[model samples]
Target: MQNLQGKSIAILATNGFEQSELEVPRDKLRGAGATVHVISLEPGRIKGWDKDDWGNPVDVDRTLDSVSADDYDAIVLPGGQINPDLLRVEQKALDFISKFWSDNKTVAAICHAPWLLVETGIAKGRKMTSYPSVKTDVINAGAHWQDSPVVTDQGLVTSRNPGDLDAFCEKIAEEIKEGRHERRAA
Candidate 1:
């Protein structure tokens, strides 16, 4: 495990996030010694979607309006059918993600969350992967889509789904530890 001590990471998410996609990475990252913050659209607790139904609620440490991308070394976007669906439509959410790209910070997404990357115009020309259902959307966004457990390009890390959480989390930590990447204009 990479030593992420003193590193601050933000998990951007909201209600309907895949239970495992969000929790597993958040817990694993924190366990790796990174300071993790659960950032959402609003304050209070956000509910999660388990396999087929609603699961536990995670506390929100900060709201989107309250923080800037500069505050964290990396950002994570966890996917669920509903979560990314909701986030992709929010201008604030999209803008927040764009900042991460402009700053060259590690941007990680899993499952359907890659949709957020598309909406922010960050998908184009990058190698990425997401939930099978999101393949069309990613490719349509001009990304070089791949069928893999995890795919990374220029500090952006993406994974297929919950089953790939282990690789996803590990890659996220590795990217953050590598520090900022020199990325081309998006």
Candidate 2:
């Protein structure tokens, strides 16, 4: 496994996040020596969406209002239609993401999570993947959409769905280790 002992990963989401998408990656990253911060639109706990119904609650470590991009090494956006949709509307969440790219930090978004990327207008000209239905919106936003389980572009890594968890988790940690690959002058 790649070393991430000193890295901090920020996961942005809200109520209705997919159970596995959020928990699985968080645990795996934590086990690999990264401090995973669960950031949400609010404090306390965020609800998990399991199958078609709601499930367990995960505590929120930081609110969108309090997250500082420079405090963390990378940002993760877990997917479920509801979570990403809600996050995209919060200017602070979107701005935090923009700062990730501006500083060449990694940003990983899976399943429906890329919706927030579309909201930031940076998906343009990049290659990525997501749940099939979101393909249209991604393309409309000017990205090259793929059918792969995971696709990483310009430090942004995206996965298709929960079925791709192994590939998803591996890539996330890799990107976290790949860490802050500096962008070239355009």
Candidate 3:
């Protein structure tokens, strides 16, 4: 209904992801007519964390090693402390994100997922929002960090946490529809 038909949306996540953060957006984006694919560190499936405990399982669409930046219109990074913290340490995962930025494609990260953006070093000067705990890292990265449900600047979209999934998913859908390229990437 929101004109996202046929758009390919990719979610890059790993084990220990916040379940709601991943599920909410995945469902919302799919409902908006985008094909949502979950790309994880491994093939098969990845487990999610819900409120300090293990949650449901989500089947993986592709492994990070097999995914190419050009295959999808947008990339969503769902964060939990362990998810992004672990991903940030993987050069391949961080490199995959930078590829999206360099291509000026839509890249959205929620919660601690913004940590990947910091590691990518492509958010400098772009207005962003992330879980409050990472505000300092965002600021030090030269990005304007804010306290909000969602923040979209250029081709980058960010949200504070799972609580902001409504706004987060909506903004990501709109960004894909708008086709706004990242200015810094250009």
Candidate 4:
């Protein structure tokens, strides 16, 4: 694992997030020595969705309005059907994600979280992957969708689903270490 000391990473999520999708990366990144913050739409804790039911609550490190893209080296979006569905419709969420892409910072999304990429207009022309059900949406947004554990274009990293968590988290650390990329703005 890379030594991520001094690196700051933001895990943007909210209630209904896939439990493992959010927990795994947050734990992995923090274990690698990066400061990980769980930023939600509101303060306090947010509940997660497990395979079929509600999961444990994760404490919120900060609310979306309280943080800026400039404070972190990378941003991660954890996917759950409900999580992305809710976030994609929030203009605030969309704009926050767009800022990361526009700044060329590492923008990582796993599973259905890629929906945010499409909404933020950053999926166009990028080779990425997401949950099987999100394939059509990604393609419609002009992305070259692939059926792989993980795919990366520029600083954007994506994974198919929970099965790809290992690769997803590893790639996130790698991308953060690579620093900002020189890519077309969203």
Report model 4's TM-score to 2 decimal places.
0.97
Tens-digit per-residue lDDT, 77-115, candidate 2? 899988998888888889999999888989889999989
Pairs with backbone N, CA or C atoms under 3 Å apart (clashes), candidate 2: none
What ranges in model 4 sit over 4 Å off?
Answer: 184-186
Task: Compute the lDDT of residue 65 as modeled in candidate 1.
Answer: 96
- How does model 4 fare in lDDT? 0.93
Off by over 4 Å in 3: 182-186
User: How do the residues 1-186 of candidate 4 rate in per-residue lDDT, one tens digit apiece?
Assistant: 688999999999989999999999999999999999999999999999998999999999999999998899999999999998999998888888898888889999999999999988899999999999999999999999999999989999999999989999999889889989999643
Weakest lDDT window of 10 consecutive positions for candidate 1: 177-186
TM-score (all chains, Cα) for each model: 0.98, 0.95, 0.95, 0.97
Best by lDDT: 1
Q: On residues 17-129, what C-alpha lDDT tens digit does candidate 3 reach at each position?
A: 99999999899889888888999888888999997899999999899888898889999999999899999999999888988888889999999999999999976888999
Model 2: runs farther than 4 Å from truth? 184-186
lDDT of each: 0.94, 0.88, 0.89, 0.93
* Candidate closer to the true structure by TM-score (higher is better), 3 or 4: 4
Q: Which ten residues in a row have the lowest lDDT in candidate 2?
A: 177-186
Query: Once model 2 is optimally superposed onto the true structure by TM-score, how far is the C-alpha of residue 98 displaced, in angstroms?
Result: 0.9
